[model samples]
Target chain A: MKPGTDWKNSYRANVFEEIPCGIVVIDRNLRIVDQNLAFTNIFGDGRGQTCYEVTRGRHTPCAECLAEQTFRDGQRRSREAMGVDPAGKPVHHLVQITPIRDETGNVPFVAALTTDLSATKRLQREYQTLFEKVPCYVTVVNRDYRVVKANTLFRKVFGEPTGEHCYQLFKRRHERCPECPAEQTFLDGGSHTSSHVGITRDGTAAHYVVSTAPLVQTDGETTHVIEMALDVTRLHRLEAELLRANALREALVENSPYAILILDQRRRVVLANRAAEKLWDCDRSTLIGHTLPRRAIACRLDEIVGRNGGPAPLVDSTIVTAKGVEIPVRLSGFTLHPVEGERSTAIIAQDLREIRTLEREKLDAERLAAVGQTVAGLAHGIKNILTGLEGGMYVTSGGLARHDEARVKQGWEMLERNIGRVSALVKNLLAFSRGDEPKPRLVRPAAIVADVVSLFKELAEQHDLVLETEISDVAPASMDAEGIHTCLTNLISNAFDACLVSHKPMCRVLVTLREENEEIIFEVTDTGCGMDYEVKQKAFTSFFTTKGSGGTGLGLLLTRKIVQQHGGSVTFESSSNEGTTFRLRFPRRRLPPPVEEEHNGS
Target chain B: MSREPSLHAPRVAIIDDEEDVLTFVRIALEDAGFTVEALDRPTEALATLEAFRPHVILLDLLMPEQMGVSLYTELRASPVLRDVPVIIVSGLNARDTLQEASAATGAGPPAGYLEKPVDAAALLDAVRRALSHSGRGTP
Candidate 1:
């Protein structure tokens, strides 16, 4: 059982027959001398035929035949070859040819041991396809920074770079990029990544992120680098657009006229604009990372945070600045979502101090104008009284000189009448000129109407006028109670006079009180002699009276003043010889605020 | 200032809303020997004025029910009274009231303007001057 002899017998019986790869023997004449089963299975029995005829179905010996070289030099040779099988299907194999010599060691045959490599070749082909068809640019560069190899996508994007430097092929630059990742990989034999702008075949810029990996030799020497570059031009464009939009938004917020405050979810001020700092009389550094300036703004922000996404209506509020000065402001709020799942609240405050001041000045100007008009009317009234006094003096003196008793009595009567008128005029003037703020209290409007009505009820009855009330239950309001009483009394007394002047046997006076549209309304209707065109034209003017010698002409004026103080209006409709209806409308919201009890007590 | 009334005494008409003014003017004119008619209401003054056929007319600018300016305009339009000299007496400013009345009525200014508190002497003087201006003074 010697090893060498046993192996030769085993090789014929088992090794050669059972081997998975194809094997064949050929002579110097280029004929197939012997073949293994694996070879027969592939080429289908090639005995008595040339090796090229069995493997390639060729009639002549193949050019550059490895077995012919082995037979001439008595050496061994190997090569990978492609041929057709029994079924004419493509086969790939690796052949090893060794010379088989006789005892003389000259002019010998060769055995070509073939290994079927069709499956391995198929796998290699698939891998090659994958490498070429990858979406990104792949390049293999040598130590000199030249692209030794490139993939299909690289060739298409950068144009075939046979021996061109990677920088020149990818960036169209004659010099290497300063921060080249491939150079770093070559230095350290480690992977590196960097972003670059490459030029495409179409002469357009292509943004890419390139990763460089060292292709190290067995000796651990870094010779070349493999670069995998992902095109990110679209992502870069998107990022640039987003940056522009963010910058524009920031500019708008900073330059807005109204004060803007952005509060994070924790109700801390994350951002405050220049206007906000100015309004609060503070610096942005002081405001940032802090809560709202005052309770008013904080309360509004809290309320808006509850209502996600939309804007809150503007509300009148008061804020205290850093210097402790209270200012009126109109506040509006919005809930903003700058990012998903993150919430913020924005408050916009509009300063109303200037507007309030303007309104007050306008009111003062109107009041001054009214006072001027009233003074003119006062002059006219005083002159008329003076004329009456002068007439009395002239008649009394004339009658006394003549000793005419009847004329003297007549002149004395004139004097008395004028003196009484003067007293009345002075009293009414004092009342009209008393420009005091209203004393507001919580009182029922209907009660004031009822009080005035009751005061005039007996007079109305005596005048044969049917006086009635149509009062509905109404809410109490903040108002000047005595002022309202005076207004009602003036209106009702005028109604009685109108009825008397009508000379009608039966006259009706109706007073009604109601509430509607958040306003209190009182209306008085009289079936009495109404104003003519001239009387109506001068109804609200100074010292213009229908009741000559009886009216000081201050009743309507005082009533109007009182109504205006209560933030109410007086309007009347009258038709000559028919009737007059006067309306007093008071909106609840506009009514004067209630006076504090302490002040009232004082 | 007593004078005897004669048949040729200049007749004067006074229209005013104030009864005291009307009475005083009437007595003053009567004592000066001019025949006078005084009416308190402007509504009645026009008819009474036409009936009295006064040589001069006195009008108050402000009156209830109707403005005296309008009454004066009506009197000017009256065929019989259009020639009578009309004087304006008002509590308002005399020149302004007269100008306003003249502008509003599109008529000539009144014979004289008198702001109120006008005394008896001034009233008599104004009346006599108006009568003379109309060429109807008592001889």
Candidate 2:
């Protein structure tokens, strides 16, 4: 083996073919003289061919050829060049050109080394696109809080930064922010996030959340920070509106005049207004979060929540306070069911103490007005009676002065009749003004009807009226016997007077006693002169007399008073020229309590 | 004044519900030299007054069978009795009632008013004045 031959073999094996680059040797005339395997694989076997034809697919050399410079200066030159393969596909590569020297050291050929860089350029383009078109405003900041680079979105919002601080661009602040996440990331070399209000180029505030990551180089020193800020202005506005609405609702519930209480599904009080506190006679703290006692509400919770498919009906009831005092109230309740969360019930209560007091006062006023009317009526009745007396005196004295017998007789009769009227009026007045409470005892209603019938029988016969009695089996009721008797007597007498004035030859009177619907009813029906509109309107009101000098007008009034005391009512039906019916109705439940029984020891 | 029928006496009508009131008022008017017709039932008063054609009428406002004011309305509406002078005598406030009735019916007021319990002289004086005011005074 020769020494030179071994060295050439080793050079081809180790340097020319084994290197991962395409190598080509070219003459000073831009012709390919020799090539490696990588060169042949890239340019497709270009032995003894012009370099421009093989690498550029051109008949002429490149405009700025580095191989010419290398051959002219006998020095190496490096550059990036775009060339094509035999298939006409362009390739990006870094090429280093060096002149090959002869034994005299004169420039003869140039060796060009090519490294393909297409994959690295594609990766660089992808990274730049991602950095420019991302949805967030991305920026790179240095240790001085200055913005070294900014993304497209950041430039659109804050304009171009000429080495300006990030605080100045993002927040338009002259000084650094007090609580900066970027500063924290720089110190700890960790990621951090914060929220801030930034000013856009148009001077509008932009709400954003910024996440900062420290950019540590190979030396592991955090020299820069990458900040990604997401715009949240619309979300911020929505949050503020929601808070305002919630505050308004709270204010409305707090200032309501009604006693409002909100209860959870378990019937525990959750919220109570000021009015509710006053009505329940308890503190707000005591009522809230506490289940009300059963006696306090005086009703079942289920009934209030289930009735009417909505709010419960208002009910007049009594509620016991914390102090065991009873308070009258009108109560109502409603339920609220939400799509999410527990269902609740709201109770509203109104204090009825003031209303009850007002009702009582109104009753008293009406009574006073009735009394005043009675006094006025009494005065008028007395005036008419006095008028009668005076007229009698006048006639009697005048007849005496004239010595006339028939005139004196007429005058004397008038005087006697008026005197009798006066006596009757006094008796009726005494009975009416007595106002004594009835001493009730158990008495059969039929017996009372029978007595009334018997008493009126004689008068009926005299007046040619057919008087009858109807008695049905009825239970005994507690009643004032004498008071009932007086009532019956007055009704019978009035019926008799009605018949006499009717001018009808045939008139009937019937007194009925019966039981109906747990009530004892005594009705006196008379076929007589019924009242007219004017008379009926004034019938039960005052001293209205229709029987000339016979009626004192206190009969029905006294009857009504007695009936009221016995917890009964008197009603009448009358029509002109037809008849009249006076009904005395006594409900069994409303009758006075029976007198206590006493027994003597034997 | 005496209880004798006189042809020259001024005719008078006394309307009341009470028999005693009618009797006394009639007697008093008759004693005062007037021919009087006493009416106990107001339902019958219109026919009687139309027949008697009295120079003066004494009306009681309150009555059971019919209101005297209603009867007064009929009298004032009557062709013959409309011109007759009516003196209201009642236990009620007859003047106020007449005014109220007049306001409603658009009729003229009564010639005179006398409340109940009036003296005989006052009643006679009222009748006389009414008769005089109506141009039918008794000579």
Candidate 3:
């Protein structure tokens, strides 16, 4: 059984039909081609049919048929074509056709080879989708930093970037970045990351975290660099805000006007502001952490806390600074409650010096206004009296020239009476001008009222005016006793004088003292020929006289001034021909602390 | 038979709202050897001035109804009394008001200005100066 020539040829044909690539043999007429198993599997049973009908399912030769051209030109040709498989699914095939002749120098048939390209086609589609849909901007650049390929986001963010340098689109610069991550990745062949501030295509500045990786070729050479940029503009803004807030807090604490001092739970100064340093007349470093002296800081926190009869929080208390100057301060504090094992208090001391100064100024202004009103009223009264005197003098002089003795005597008496009136006016004016400057000494108000009544009793008896005293046993008020005595005497004496012209010719003077609220009140009530509206209007005015030639009008003015100096007020209620009652109220309080002067009396 | 003095007596008019002031001025002027006519009321002063045709007039500044300045203005406006001289006797701060009134009344404020509480000698001197300056009588 020696192998015949047909048997060897048949065996080689079987091997060729089983090859992975599809094979077909077509005649010169472009008719049915001899097809291999792979070809029959791809294009389906092609014997006794045209090549176009078998591969393209077309009844005629396909457009731009290279196999027909190859038979005519006796040349070999290759092309990519679309074909359908037995399952009716589309396939892309790489096809090659070569003309074969049987040693006759003529083309008899063409053998075509096709390769399935569906796997490579699907892989390219997947790569395109990933490039387009990734969150970050992605770009591939050549060694020169020029853009080679960019995804849809990269093209949309920095439009049509191919053929332009990546630095130009990302950094908006003509030159590359000084420390470009892409260049570093190319040089190192490893991933490089950096934070960069860049300007976008829309001319907005943004911060980006850019990572670059080298794209290595088969020959171990870095051909391109891939860059991914993540925008971090909002994070940078947050960091800036935090830094600015910290600086503002420090500045506010340093420049606050109030003397602010922080004390630890042990009552030691921990922190002091600029105002505290100046108020204490010591450097901040020296005062901080020092145990506050009890005498210098007069306010005892224990006292206020005990008064509340509970576990007291930080309370408002007076504190004298290191300079030996007393200051009113609001001391508010709270325990650091939640901090475990931390037995500390946060205390803030706000100085009340400015408020005290404002109050002093207001009191001074009120005093001056009262004095001015009194003076104006006095001037008006004096002007009327002077006009009367001028009239009398003119009439008297004329009468003397005419030798009228009766007229002369009347003028002389008028002159004498008016001179006495003027003298009394001068004396009262002097008294009012020199108001009682309070020489405060602790004394019982009831005793003063009793003494005043006793002194005036004889005078009241002589004037047919009864004097009575009703004194209350109250707490002693600090005041000038002599001022109180003088005021009571003047009031009682006026009551006696008022009764002189009344038809009834009877008068009553009552002096009483009592304590109400935190104040002591001394009241003087009189029943006599009470004042009319006009007289009452000018009651406290200097030089206003209801007794014609007897009244000097400075009594009540002086009394009021004296009462006010003792931290008290003088007020009255009166009705025409009814009676008059004067009440002097003295608050049970001491004079406010003197304002801190930049320098003591110079 | 007695012979009367041939020398003419100077006639003076004193106008003031106060009767005592008018009487005092009359006495002072008469003692200085001048015939005087005193009018206490401002309205009556103008009538008395016309009748007496005085060589000098003493006028008080402030009065009811018609003040010294207004009376002076009215007197200067009349043709019959335009030549009469008026001396404003006032207790007011009168330096500025007198000057202003002098400009308003063409006859001028007075030959001399006198304040209140005027002495007899000063009053006599002003009358004499006014009469001599007006050429109405020899001082």
Per-candidate clashes, comma-separated:
0, 0, 1
Cα distance off (Å), candidate 3, residue A544: 12
Instruction: State the lDDT of candidate 3 residue by residue for B1-139, as single tens digits.
Output: 1123234777778776555455456645654567778775565577668877877778876553346677777777766678877776765445677678768666555666776657667777787777778876643
Error of 1 at B54 (Å): 4.7
TM for every model, in the order presented, reads 0.56, 0.61, 0.43
**Residue B66 C-alpha lDDT in model 3:** 48
Give the winner by DockQ: 2 or 3: 2
DockQ for every model, please: 0.54, 0.54, 0.05
Choose 1 or 2, whichever is better by lDDT.
Answer: 2
* Residue pairs whose backbone atoms clash in candidate 2: none
Off by over 4 Å in 3: A1-137, A151-158, A170-172, A197-208, A216-218, A229-249, A259-273, A276-316, A320-602, B1-139
Candidate 2 stretches with Cα past 4 Å from truth are A1-258, A262-268, A271-348, A597-602, B1-3
Measured by TM-score, how close is model 3 to the native structure?
0.43
Tens-place lDDT per residue, model 2, A1-602, is: 69999998989677897687899888888788888888888888988888888877888788888888877788888988888988888977889998789999988989999887667778879988998999999999999999999999989877887899998998889999999999999888999999999987788999999999987554777999999999998899899999999899778778776688889987789999888888888999999999978898887766555465754788778778888889898887888787999989888778889999999999999989989887877777887788888878887888789897777777788788888888988899898988788878898877887887897778788879999888999887898888999999989888888888999999998888888899889898899999999988888876888877888989999999999988899999999888899999988899889776656744
Model 3 Cα lDDT, one tens digit per residue, A1-602: 45787788888798778998898888977876588888878888879888887778777788889988888898889998888786778989989998878888888898899888888878879977987788778889998889888888877778887589988888889998999998888777889999999898778888889999987554787889888887777888888888999889778878977666666677787778898787777899987888767675556654434233345455556776666777786665545444565444444566767777888998999889867866665554454345335545644775688787775665565566656666777777777776536666667778888887888777777777778888879876666778888787787777676565443566777888888888888888888667666566767766455553355667887887787777788888877667778888877774222234345556
Residue-level lDDT tens digits of model 1 in A377-478: 778887888888888888998889999899899999989999999999988788888788889999988888888888987887677789999999998899
TM-score of chain B of each: 0.89, 0.93, 0.84
DockQ-derived CAPRI band for the predicted complex in model 1: medium
Error of 3 at A325 (Å): 7.6
Best candidate, lDDT = 2
Candidate 2: what lDDT?
0.86
Q: How accurate is candidate 3 locally (lDDT)?
A: 0.72
